[model samples]
Target chain A: MTRILPALAVAVTLSSFGSFTASADPLPSWVSSGTKDQIVEFVTAVTTPDSTDYVTPADRIAVFDNDGTLWAEQPVYFQFIFAMDRLAELAKQDPSILTTPTLQAAAKGDLETVLQGGHNALIEVVNASHSGISVEAFQAAVADWLDTARHPETNLPYDQMTYQPMVELLRYLRDEGFQTYIVSGGGLHFMRVFAEEAYGIPPEQILGTYANTTYEQVDGVPTVIKAPGIAFIDDKGGKPINIERTIGKRPILAGGNSDGDFAMMEWTSAGEGPRLGVLIHHTDAAREWAYDRESPIGKLVDGLDKGPGMGWVIVDMAQDWSRIYTGAN
Target chain B: MTRILPALAVAVTLSSFGSFTASADPLPSWVSSGTKDQIVEFVTAVTTPDSTDYVTPADRIAVFDNDGTLWAEQPVYFQFIFAMDRLAELAKQDPSILTTPTLQAAAKGDLETVLQGGHNALIEVVNASHSGISVEAFQAAVADWLDTARHPETNLPYDQMTYQPMVELLRYLRDEGFQTYIVSGGGLHFMRVFAEEAYGIPPEQILGTYANTTYEQVDGVPTVIKAPGIAFIDDKGGKPINIERTIGKRPILAGGNSDGDFAMMEWTSAGEGPRLGVLIHHTDAAREWAYDRESPIGKLVDGLDKGPGMGWVIVDMAQDWSRIYTGAN
Candidate 1:
């Protein structure tokens, strides 16, 4: 599928990212470093017809993990914060919800105490805040929240807190004929709300954890109600499973930031021919929150240790990225 | 996103399907009939920027159901035949499988008796035949079977049994900048093997029923092993659910051939803009096997009955389609 070009022409195309012209820098936010070079080299190799690693445009699938990889997950995941804020609002209205143990922890913003309840507690919070409403109502609610809600640490809207370098990488990939997809652990609808505006990935290409939905006719209007139960989890090993279930082909490129992404990376790297696995290590404390290997959310211990041996690229945020937050520059 | 082409240019573009020339017939196999005209009208309206019903190219999602609609599903669903053939092969190797009642029924090609055991029995058959194998191995098996297996009645390869007119429609829509997807009740991987080659729809765009898969390492190789459990069922109410789960947006156009597609049609028609619901009624018994209303497989009762009231285009196969099968001149 690759059109033959002269070596000089190929070099010009590689240097140009957004415009696809001769001299535009695709990853301007990305510093001229080994990590950036690695990304460019892999993309160029797969897209070049004469290269042994050439892959067709139809097969140029790139999956990205959302939480920490695309945006900040510090001081608890942004979705958790949304759920907590929602719990607070609901508690004020219901009053009775305040007495429930799990709801009480969530209302108090005590995620640690809520964690004591384990996976069920998280599911309960997610269900209470995310489900039982119509899909439209939920989407509207999320839209409203995201419009006003600011990250506690950054004081910027959650959408604006998306990493600048990563955003550029997404654009660059898309410019190069790769169909970019967000294979996130976040709620499917939650990501769909801002994915197109933030990442340039359309809703159809966004695969994520989803709640069960029931189809029904309400007053002559067809409606899909979000049911109060988890349908599919798009995390850890489930990531690879969901990718296969949704995409039907093994992705040539995948990026993530935690131990949860190890299996996804493993699955992508294990595919035949050329494949690229990227692990984003949060090592910028001054610019952005830096906690890895021991962080409660988005831990990166096993991935950091195993990535090098597996030929996966470990992107040290502080060193590899010239910019962190999109809001910064 | 539609450009305001000159009236002459618009007519030329519409006439030319593949080359975008002035004289090529987009639906050559499709007779110059009302059904074909209706399709052309819908495509033009949606693609015309000046038209009130105009939709952007990004939102121009057209979903097609496999089986009876796109291909022949007369003697039995092709996938079922593959399963039966696989069961026979397995039974020959392991005589003990014949001792089990469901396996015995499957091996004898008695789907009715196997279905009498209910949904669980069907799942058991699918698992016994399709699971506990690596994804690559399963794909290879399906590929090998497709290469040799012939339709019992048609004696044509299953892929060749596709409707040439419908194939033309797929290309026409794609040429008009619409993204085509196969939303089928067939297994996800099963449709994927032939979807791209037959319909020009890639694996990522193919949405269907899927089995659960587990990610694991087998002798230092990463593998996604298909587990012995039904992950998702993409039929009836499940179709709308899976559509939202996978596509994240309601499609503008949907085509199907059975009562199983009613909810999908309802979902598409209920969306906020101009939408089209197409029900392909099998009425050509001479050229193609005709079965509807009372047919055990691919039943078209409710859809044929309720489709007209819902503003759906009920395509009479004998009248609307000039050609039934691809193999037929």
Candidate 2:
């Protein structure tokens, strides 16, 4: 996938503001200084007309970890919130969800209670909410809930609260001719719901963890059966593995914001030629929230320590980025 | 899935000096005055904006059977030929292949002898060539071989021998905003090699028959392991099942020219919108050889009758299409 333009430059413009510009002058104000400088330098090294790292637009592969890198992953994942809301909505009809461990813990609705149980609690909550339903029904349920759902804490629909800068980067890269994909631990189907509308990337382009689907004949026609199988887990160490296995290309640009994304960034940096590795350090508490090493969610200290001048850019979310989200109304 | 263009009328333009524009400004020469009228009426019904047969671009999903539909599938499947070459290439280095029934058959270039075993032959051939190779290595091998090898029958590289008229039709449909995908019985990995270059489709977009692959940690890097699992066949009735299982969307346009493709065309026509089923009947034996029910490849009987008045266009290859493969230099 050859990129027509530089991704970092385009991303800065997109992340900062939503001002459409003439194609000849696509660069924006945020294209220089701080975070943009690091991004541009990496791009230049890899894409310079005659640089050794110079790969044609056809090989300008870039993959991003969606959770913290592309959006907000805080006290609890947004999907978990969707599940809790679903549980409450379904509780009116099916009260046993109140007794299901994961649903019960979610119904309790205290962040501390969830952290007490750890990863087990998270997977349990997800399986309880997502399994059993047909893939269509699950997708419809997700789409319906996403249409009206808002994060209780942020007070904005989860789609809006997505990191504004990341969205710009994706479009900038795509406009430049780079193929941008979401490789995340999040349910691949869940991401497909708002991915295209919010990010403008199609469902086929987004690759993430997915439950297995079965095939069967229905009535006179063949219909697919959606079942819960651990078909894919596109997260943590799985990120790089999944990308290579599916896309069959090594990414030149990789951006992530947590320990979960550490391996993904490492994988990008290990690839040949001029490469870009970036970490979105959340240090803006007033505009956003700041916590890295000590935070339970999105810890990035290890990556930051490794960043410095190691060809990896550490973006100070508070200062480097100028806006939150485009949230197109 | 929203398209930017309005529905363009599908017309065949014919000229008085024995040339045709392949559009309907002046009907095709093959469609007699009566046949042309019938076709115009059918097209009118299908494309009428308010008719029960009107189909939106979103509903214009087109599924194409590869093999004989796109490129020549004569002298046996191109994949088998490649596998035979590969077996011979790698045979000296690995002697155990001689003991493997399928490997021996392929290595010896006695494919017909191998097929004497019937289903067992197909199983052995697929397992030997595909299984155990890393998906990446297999893709590389395919790309490498396709780049160098020429089809014995055509003397043109396999990719160069694709049907030109069909290629143009595919481009036309894509320009019209139809989502196109290859539904083939060929091994998924093998098709991924030239699919994008030949059909303008990405590998991830292809849904085909597959022998499963596993995951293994080679050295420190995790690599996908391709194994000879029970093959996932995407031929005949399996085509629709695989399509529904993978894409979960039904196609409105289906093009194929074999019994294996009949089930696919039937599946597409079953959709509730204005459907188009085109059968490429090889009526030309001069420019190209013709065969039907007795031929081992591309048998086109069922689709011819069952598909006629129901909006199916039976292409008289000799009369309807002017060019075969696009000029490959």
Candidate 3:
């Protein structure tokens, strides 16, 4: 789609911050002279008219990876945790549902056993917990879990575990005429349950790994029921492919924390004209959980090594963020 | 995703009509006593605050079918015609590419023979013409086709065959805070090429049938190239399923011209609160080509038989539309 300039630019500011003033800093949670400066510089260069890097508002598309980029992904992905909890809940009602060894391990909260079984095992756990229900019911289940469930370590609500500075950045980008989308490896239905409230991104803008669904008429009402199979996994190479398939335009900016997002960042960086690839490096142990290259979940080896050489910005959480979780002590 | 009302509403109107006024009419191409009045009444009921049928702006999503709903699908689907032309162009370069009978028939413009070969044959013709190119290159090819390809019967550019009243309807809905989307069985990439230019809808808002794609690094640049396999067909039951998977919300209104879109209208009508299902009955044989119920292309059996009984607005193109093509005499 060839987009025209200026006409697509509307004053529909999505800043959670109050009306922007000349002196008001949009990203108040970000410390100066680090990732904040990099972001500001890139946005200004692309948005400022008469600059060679100027991009039209219609082409100002930005994508973000959810788990470790926008929020904390320690121990394991939050969606994986949600699946475990849901499996346990489902098993309590009908113990026979826990047939497979992976399902049994996941339902019993034996994370060690489930993790030992590998990626296929994790997918089994997710499919068992996530499927065989109506899309609305599954979303309701997720919403219910988020309402009561708390992180084992921080005890913070999963939705509230989102990074304060990252949320601020999302809002800041939207204010700069960029359409921000969450292109993550999280389950599409799982993320859609709380993404709008958590990150100010709508469900339509949230693209992620999804399960196969079948449309059926239940009780005289048209319904889409989740089925027991993975449709597409929006991770690694799949990220860029899904983005192109859905958005049809190469995003100008991409953000992620793990190697799973490397393909998306690479794709964005390779696009013509002004581009920015942001990688959030986990370095703030005291404020937020810190794990990087060797971490089982959200391992950052590729990003840490290759991102900078690709002119991508690697954000140091310890040095760049003045705040971690929103309103955290 | 559960949407919070009034807050989501913004003044991001996409009206090509100068400005809204009490005396100014929005649908000038539509005759007032028919489907236009049905649409106006429904929109007014849902949008007016304090009304019994009032709905939030966030829930005001309307979907339209492309081939026959938004434009004319006379002799056959326009995309099929595009495929035939594209196959001819490709065969001109490499004769061996036309190995199959379907390909040969399509390249030679023998529509009768191609049609006799059935749906699989059409798919073969399409996949052969549409794949093996970078997404950008394929879109460029489509743009080129729309620029030069004229509808054989009308001698008008293919893009110009769009209905003016439907265009106005899309803009009016957007002006009233509805997010209008094209949910068609037409090729996703093909529609995205001209959808924004012809209908004011961005690529992200268009959902349709898509081919399998592969991500590869071509000359060190990340590229998505179309492959020769049908990934998902966005028609019939697939329409509602795709909508649920992609948008994660049931649309409030759906407009289509045939039974292929029946599932979409059914899904929209079954949603809670104010709903509308619009079926465009092609009845203008004098002004425009018209066929229904028995026409192989855009056969309208289910929509004609059950739509009115379901409270769906059956738009009589002859009576309801004062004009067919945007600028046609």
Task: List where candidate 3 sits over 4 angstroms from the true fold.
Answer: A1-20, B1-20
Q: Name the candidate, 1 or 2, with the larger lDDT value.
A: 1
Every candidate's DockQ is 0.71, 0.15, 0.65
Tens digits of per-residue lDDT for model 2, B99-214: 66666877888878776676566667666766787788888988999989987766888888788767766665675567788888887788888888888877656877777655
Candidate 3 residue lDDT tens string, A1-329: 23643333432442322355655998998888767888999999999998899999999999999999998887888899999999998888999999988899898888999999878888989989999899999999999999998989899998899999999999989989999999999999999988898889998999999999998989877899999899999999999988887887899999999999999999999988989999999998888878988887888888889999988988989998888996374
Q: Give the per-residue lDDT of model 1 (tens digit) for A179-287.
A: 9999988999989999899989998899998999998888878888899889888899999888888887899999999988989888898889999998999989989
Q: For residue A232, what is the lDDT in candidate 2?
A: 61
What is the C-alpha lDDT profile of model 2 across A1-110, one tens digit per residue?
Answer: 24745787789889666554533322242435567866766566656678876678877778887877788887667887886777667776887767656566676665
lDDT of 3 by residue, B305-325 (tens): 888878899998999988999
Q: Model 1, range B1-329, lDDT digits (tens) per residue?
A: 24656776878866675355635788888778888888889999999999999999998989989988899886767887888789888889887766579988888988779767865676677778998898888888999998998887778888899999899999999999999989888899888888888888888899888888898888988888988878888989888888887887889999999988889988998898899998998888898978898887788778877778877888888887778788766
Local lDDT at B26 for model 1: 86
Off by over 4 Å in 1: A1-20, A116-119, B1-20, B111-122
- Deviation (Å) of A67 in candidate 1: 1.0
Interface RMSD of each: 1.0, 3.9, 0.8
TM-score of each: 0.92, 0.76, 0.93
Worst 10 residues of 1 chain B by lDDT: B14-23
Q: For candidate 3, give the lDDT of residue B237.
A: 97
